[model samples]
Target: MVKRRDVRNRLLRLFVGVLLIAACSAQAAEMGGKSDARILIDISGSMKQNDPQNLRRPALRMLVGLLPEDARAGVWTFGQYVNMLIPLGQVDAAWKNKARAEAGNIASPGQFTNIEDVIKRSIADWEGSATLYQRHLILLTDGMVDISKNTKKNAASRQYILEQLLPKLQSHDAQVHTIALSERADHELMRTLSRETGGWYEQVNDAEHLQRVFLRIFEKVGRPDTVPLKDNKFLVDSSIQEVTLLVFRKESAEPTQVITPSGTQFDAKSAPQNVSWHRDIGYDLLTISHPETGEWRIQAAMDPDNRVIVVTDLKMRSSQLPSRFVLGEVLPVTVSFTNQGKQITRKDFLDVVNLKSCHTDSNGTGEARPIFDDGQDGDKAAGDGEFTLQVGQGLAAGKVELVILAQGKTFQREQRQLFELADPIPMQVTSTDEGETKVRVQPDAELVDLESLEIKAALVSQAGEEQPVMLLPSAEAGVLETSIATQELLGDWTLSISATGQTRSGTELDLTLDPVRVRGTATPPADPPEEVVEKTPEVQEPAVEPATMQAPLADEPATEEDNSTFQVALFGGINLLLIILVVLAIWIMRRRKQEPEFQLVEEDDQLVEEATAK
Candidate 1:
C-alpha cells in the first residue's frame, strides 16, 4: 500500500507541472497575438534623389506580406501632407496585393517632409481600430521635419512630435520604431521618439538594407519567441538611456546574473544603485537605470528553458493638444511624464521644462515666444506643466507645431504637437432699400482660389417662428442680395445668415454671420378720403331757351297737313340733339378716369421693366 501511494503522488506532481507550463505558453502566445502595426513611408521630394534604387517600394511589399495573416496593418505615405493609403484591417492576400500596388504607385513629388503630420494621422487611424494589446508604428524617413525659415515653425514641428504624437502612441500601448534612411535624417529626434515609446531606433546607410531591417522588425513583432530561454547575451547601444530585462522561467528559485559592458557583474541579492530586480512565479525582472552605452550580458540557470526580453526604460505621458485653430486664438498644451506605468511626481523630473511654438508656411516660418502664466491668458497655474501660446498674429496660415522639452538629472526628453491654422470667415451685412438685406461674403484673404460658397438667411420672430429669406446673388462679385418686406415682417425680427463653402477643394468652412436687427423707413401714410361738395340749381339758363322757341313756333302752323309735318320735324330734331349731348358727356367722363378702351393690363409697366432688366 505504501509503494502504491508513492507512485500516485509522483504522478500528481507531474500533472501539476504540465499544467503550469501550459499556462505560461498560453500567456506568451496571447501576447504575440495582440499586435497591430502601421507602416509609414516618407515620399518627400528628397526621397526621389536619396533612394535611387527605390528599395522602399519592395521593402513595403515584403513587410505587408510577412506580417501575420491575422494581424491588422495599415499603410501610409507622407510628404507635405499625410495620406493613408490603406486603413487598418486584416492582412489577407487580397488586401496585401492592393497595398503593394498602392505602394509602388507612391510618387515623391511632395516638397516638404511633414513627419509630425504623418505621425498624428497614423495615431488617429489606430486609436479606435487597432488591437487593444499591442499597437506599433514603423516610421521610415530620409529627412528631418521640413523646417521653415521661421524659428518658431521649426520648434513647433518638434514640439508636436514630442507632446501630441508621443503621448497618443503610449496611451494606445503602441510602440514607434523609427528608421533613419540617411545621415541627413534627424537621428537624435528619431532615437528619442523610439526610446520614449519603448521602441527601437535604427540607422541604415543605404536603401538596400531597408528590406532586411523591416523583415527583422516584423519577426520581432509577429513571431515573438515562445521557447523559454536557457542563457542569452545582448548588446545595449549608447543611444539607449535605460534597459529592462524580463526573464521568464518555470522556476523562480533559479539564480540570475547581469553583467554590464564594463565587465562589472551583479546578481539579484547584490544589485547596485542603478540596478533593481523583482521575482515572481515563473518570471524575474532586472532593470538597469541609466545603463551604460555598451553591450550587456545575462546568464541564468534553470531546469526548464527561460525567455528574456530587453526593453528600454524611458517612458512618457502627456495631454492631447488642440489640432484645429481659428485665425486669432490661443492654444494651450500640457504634458507629463511617467516611469513604468506610474506617474512621476519627483521634483527633479518635473523641473526645467521648456516650451516653444512654431508656425510653418510656404513663404517661411515664425516663432511665438512663450507666454508666461500670470493668472490670465487661459493658463491656470505656472510650473504646472500647462503651456499656452496666442496663435495667428505673426504666424502664417498653415501647419503649426508646438514643442516641449524637459530634462531631469537622469533623463532628458522632448515632445511635439501639431495643429492646422486657418483664417476666420469674413462677412459683411447691409440694409438695402425695400426691406431687403444684402450680405456680402468674401473668402478669407489668406486663402486663395476658393471653390464655392453657399449663403442662407432667416428671420427669427419674437414668437419663435423662422421665416426663410431667399438669398439672390447680384451681378457684382462676392455679393449676395436678399429682400424681406418689412411690411410682411412687422414685429421684432432677428436676421440670421449662415455660410458654408470650401476655401480650397478639401478645406471646408462653415460660419454664421452675426445677427442683426432688420430695420426700415417709417410706414407710409394711408391715402386721404375724397371731399363731398353741394351743387346749387341753375335758374337763368331755362328762360333763355324759352324765348327762342316761342318765336320759331309763331312762324310755322297754317294748313293742317303743313302743321303736322312741321311738328314732326321739330320733335325729331330735338331728340337727335339730346342723344348727341349724352354721348359727349360719357366720352369726357371715360377720358378723365384713364381706363383702357376695351383691354385689361395684367401687370404694372414699371414692375415689368425692372423684372426684365434683372
Candidate 2:
C-alpha cells in the first residue's frame, strides 16, 4: 500500500509539472501574440572559430540549434562581402538544409570586408523578400574595414557605401540589430550605427553565449509596440545622418520600384541613390544609415513630373524677435512668405507659438492671444481684431519661441518681416527740472551694424496729461540719436523712451523734467520839474524907522492925527499907484486870457519905472 501511495504521489507531481509548463507556455504565447520570433544569425568568418567558454563550439552552430522551431530563421555571412545565406523560411524543413549549406561557406578568412556593401545587400534582400516584419539584422564582426580590393583606399569603399546606402535604407524604415563578436570590430562605430537606427547593441565576451543572446534578442524584437515615426525617421532628414529614402506612392504602403536612367535597378531598400532625369515615370528609393545604431532615413523619389511635385522651400526671418527681450513687449513680428513649390496660387497660414522662460506652454502663459491672422489676405472684417490678443504680463527675459506651421499641402514658402507695437514699453521717465518739457535720447554705445532702432517716448505732466512722442533715428555715423522737443510749457514732465535696437535688446530709459521759474521788480515815473517864485523890493521906509518911529509915538495924539491926515494924503497918492497896479493886473489877466500863454517874467525895477513913466 505504501508503494502504491508513492506511485500516486509521483504521478500527481508529474501532472502538476505538466500543468505548470502548459500555463507558462500559454502565458508567453498570449504576451507574444501571433508574432513569430525572427532571428538573424551572423555567420561571418569569426563564427567559425571556437570560443574559450564553449570548447570546440562554433557560435553560429550553437545559436542555430537553440532557435525555437516555431521561429522564422535566416542566415547571413560576410567575408570580402555579404550574402543572404538563408532565405527566410519555416524552421522545419529547409531551415536545417539552408543552415548546413551556409555553415561551410560562413568562414572566409584572409578576405576583404566590405561592411557597408554587406549591410546594403542585406537591407535589399530583406526589403525585396518582404522579410522585414519582426526583422532584425545581427552583425558580428571581429575586425575593421578590409575593402582594399573594392577601392583605392581601404576605408574608401565603406565610406562610399555608407554615403550611398545608409540614407536609402533609413527612409525605408528598416530597423537593425547589432552584435560585436570582439572589441576589435569597429565596435564603437557599429554600436552607434545600430542605436541610431533603433536597434540594440551587445558585446560578446565568448561566442558560446551567442545562441542565448540571440534568443533574448528575438524575445525583445518580437514584442509588438507602436514605434513613433519621428524616432524611426530621425536619420531621414537632411540635418540627420545615416538616413535613406524608400520611395512609395504617397497613398500606398508598398514601396515603389526604383529604375535609374543609367539602367541601374536598385531595390527600394538600398541607399538613397541619386535621381536620373528622364521623360518617363521611373524613380528611385534611397536608404540612409545613421552614424548611430539603427538610425536611418528611407525616402522615395520619382522622375514623373506630374507625381513628383517639386515645391519651393520655405524661408523665414522676423525682425521682432531680438536675442533678448523683456516680458510682454509687443515686438514687431513681421513675416513674409514666398511660394517655392511647383503648385501656384496655393494658400497657406503661419502659426506663431509663444514661449515663457524659453519653454513652450501650449496653453499660452498669458491672456494675450496673437492678434495676427495665419496668413496673408486672411479675413480682418472685424475692425477691433487688433485688440483681441491677451498677452501675458511679466514674462522672464530670455529666448522666445515662434513656430510657423505650413498650411496647404502643395505649397512651398519663403518669408521675412518688420513690425511695430501700438503699445509703449512701460517705464518711468523722471527729469531733474520739473519744468523741462523736452526730451532727447540716443544709444549710450553706438550699435555697429545696426541701421537704426525704433524709439518712442511718453510724457506725463503734473496735471496728469499723458503725451506720447515718437522719434525715428537719424541716419548718421554715430549713436542713434532722436530728439523730442515739447511746446513751451510748465509743470513737471516725465520722459520715457522705449526702443528695439539691432544690436541691443528691447530697451527703455526714464527721466523727469524740472519746473522753471522767472525773476526781478518794477520802478516809478520821474517827478515833473518844480515851478519858480518871484520876490518884490521893499520901499525906503526903513531909513527913518529908528528916529521917526519914537517921535511920532510921543506926538501921537494930535500930531499923529495931523501926520495921519498927511499920511492919509500920501496913502491917497499911493492909491494912484494902487490903481495903476490894479490896472496892470487887469491888463495882465486880459493878456493871459486873450494872448498865447507866456512864462511869468521877472522884470527889472528900472523897466517897471520906465513903463510907469510912459
Candidate 3:
C-alpha cells in the first residue's frame, strides 16, 4: 500500500508541474505578442551633411528615443557595406543607447556611402528574426547616390537589390517605412518599397519637425487596448450646465473594445474626433474640451460602476479679450470659475495687488513708468468690458508687456505682452481767436501706457504766417489740453498744435500733421454806412429884362440883394412865359407832325405871309 501511494503522489506531482509550465508559457506569449516592431535606420554619407535644420545630433536622438519600450527594433547602417549593429530586440534605454552609440560610430570619420548593401542586409536580418506576422522594417536615408559607373554598374546593381529584397520582404509581410531626409531623395524607390511592403514613407526637411514624426509613429505602434464603460466612471456636474464627450480610434484596424458612459450609444463608423472605447488598449480620448470657464465633469469605464474616473471643470475664465494695447491704460479682465465637486468660490483673503504703472517705453529713450488705472479718474471699472490703459509719453515705442489683475472671487491674473503702442504723428493745432474761445488738442484715439502728449501750438493768419501762442498743459491724462485767450486774436487764424516724437524703433516722424481749429475775431472796416451827394434845383424868376438890358445894368450900381432879386424875378417871369410858349409850340408841332407833311406845310401861316410879301 505504501509503494502504491508513493507512485500516485509522484504522478500527481508530475501533472502539476506540466500545468504550471503551460500557464507560464501562455503568459509569456501574451506579454510578448504586442511589441514586435522593426526599426530600420539609414546611416548614409549624406547624414553627415547636416542638411535638415542644422540639427545633426538632436534629430537622431529623438528618432531613437521615441521607440516603444517593448518594441523590438533593428539598426542597419547602409553605406559601402551593410553594418547590422543590433538585431530585433526589445526597445529600452539600454538598447536605444547602444544603437545611438553605434550610429555615432558608423562610417568612422571618412568612409564611402553605399546604400544598396544596407537595404539587402536589413531585409535579410529582419526576415530571419521573427515569423512573417511579426516583422517590420523601416529605412532612413537621404537617398542620394554618387557612383562612377563604367558599365551601367550602379543602376543595374540598384535594380537587382530592389527587385530581389523588396519582394522577399513583402512575401514575409514585413512593413517597410522609409524616411528620406534629403530634399531630393529617390522618390521612386521609396514609393516602391512602401507599396510592396504596405508601409509609410516620409520626407522630412526640417530636423526639428522630426519629433512630431516620431510621435506619430509611436501612436501607430502603441495599439493600446480599449477601456469599456464598466472599466471607467462617469460623473455629471450637478452645478454647471451641459457637457458632451466624444471618443474615436485614430487608426481603427479591427473591431476593438469600446467603452462609454452608462446609457451612451456607440457608433462604429466614425473618425478621430468621434472615437470612444471602454477598454484601455484602444483609445480613451476626451473629445469634448472642458470649458474655459465653467463647472463640468464626466467619466467612462469598462465596468459601468467602477474602474476609472475623468473629471473636469471650468477653473478659470478671462473676461478680457485676448488683445493688447499701450501700458498705463486701464485693462479690464474678468474671469469666472467653479470646482465641479466643491461648488466653492476659490479666492483666499489677499492684500491689494497694486497694478504696475507705465510698464513700457515708447521712445526707446530708456524711459518707463508704473502703469495703473483705478477708474476713479474716468477709467474703466473692474467688471466693465471696455477698459483704457495709457501708454506713458516717456515709454519706448517698441513691444511692451503688462499683467492685468482681476480682483474677482478667483483673483485671476492675466498677462498681456508685446503690446504695440505706436508713436504719435507730428501735428499742429492753431486757433484763430486765441483770446475768447479756448482751443484744446486731444488725441483722436487714446493710446495704451501713454500719458499726456506734447501740444505745440502756433497761431497763423490768413496771410500764411505763424503767431506764437502759449500752451498750458492740463491735469487730464492722455489729453493734449490747453486754454488760449482768443479775444486778443484778430482775423481768421489757425492754431497749429503738433506732437512730435520718436517712434518705438527710434524712427523719426517728421511730417505728421493734424488739422487745427482756426478761431479769432475779425477787424471791422472804418467806412460810413451811407454817403449823400446833394443836387441844387435851378431857381427861375419872371423874365423882366433881356440880355442887352442886363449888360447895361451891369454898369449901373446894383445892391447884391436888389440885383439878385431882379435877376431872379426877371428870369423867373421870362422862364415862365417861355416855358408856356415852348410848351404850346411843342404841342402844335407834335399835332402837325402827326398829320401828313404836305398838309402841315400848306397850313403854315408863314408860307402865306412870305407869298404876300413877295
- Best model per TM-score: 1
TM-score of 2: 0.28
Q: Total clashes, candidate 2? A: 86
TM-score of model number 3? 0.32
Question: With candidate 1 superimposed using the best TM-score fit, by how many Å does residue 468's alpha carbon deviate from the native?
Answer: 95
Per-residue CA lDDT of model 1 for 1-614, tens digit only, reads: 99999999999999999998888776655554556888898888888877876778767766675564557888888888888887778887678778877877776877788888888777775554233446788999998878465768967998888888777777877778889999999998997787677576778888877765675566445642211123365555433554555554545455777887799888889899987575533445555667776556776654222322233334433444433445444445544544543555555445544444444554465654654434467667655544455444555555555444443444344444444565555556766555666666555534423446666778887888888878666677754566566665556788887766654424455656567786534466788998878777856634434213432455565669886788778767766776777788789998867667333454566678889999
- Model 2 agreement with the true structure over 296-369: per-residue lDDT tens digits: 23334332111111111332222223222333343334333332312222222332322111122333333323
Q: Rank the candidates by TM-score, best first.
A: 1, 3, 2
- Model 2 worst lDDT run, 10 consecutive residues: 303-312
What TM-score would each prediction reach against the true structure? 0.33, 0.28, 0.32
Query: Clashes per prediction?
Result: 19, 86, 118
Worst 10 residues of 3 by lDDT: 301-310
Candidate 3: residue 74 Cα off by (Å): 2.7
Stronger candidate by lDDT (1 vs 2):
1
- lDDT per residue (tens digit) for residues 12-74 in model 3: 999999999888876565454344565555555566663423343344444454454656777
How many angstroms is residue 53 displaced in model 3 relative to the true structure, after the best TM-score fit? Answer: 7.0
Worst 10 residues of 1 by lDDT: 303-312
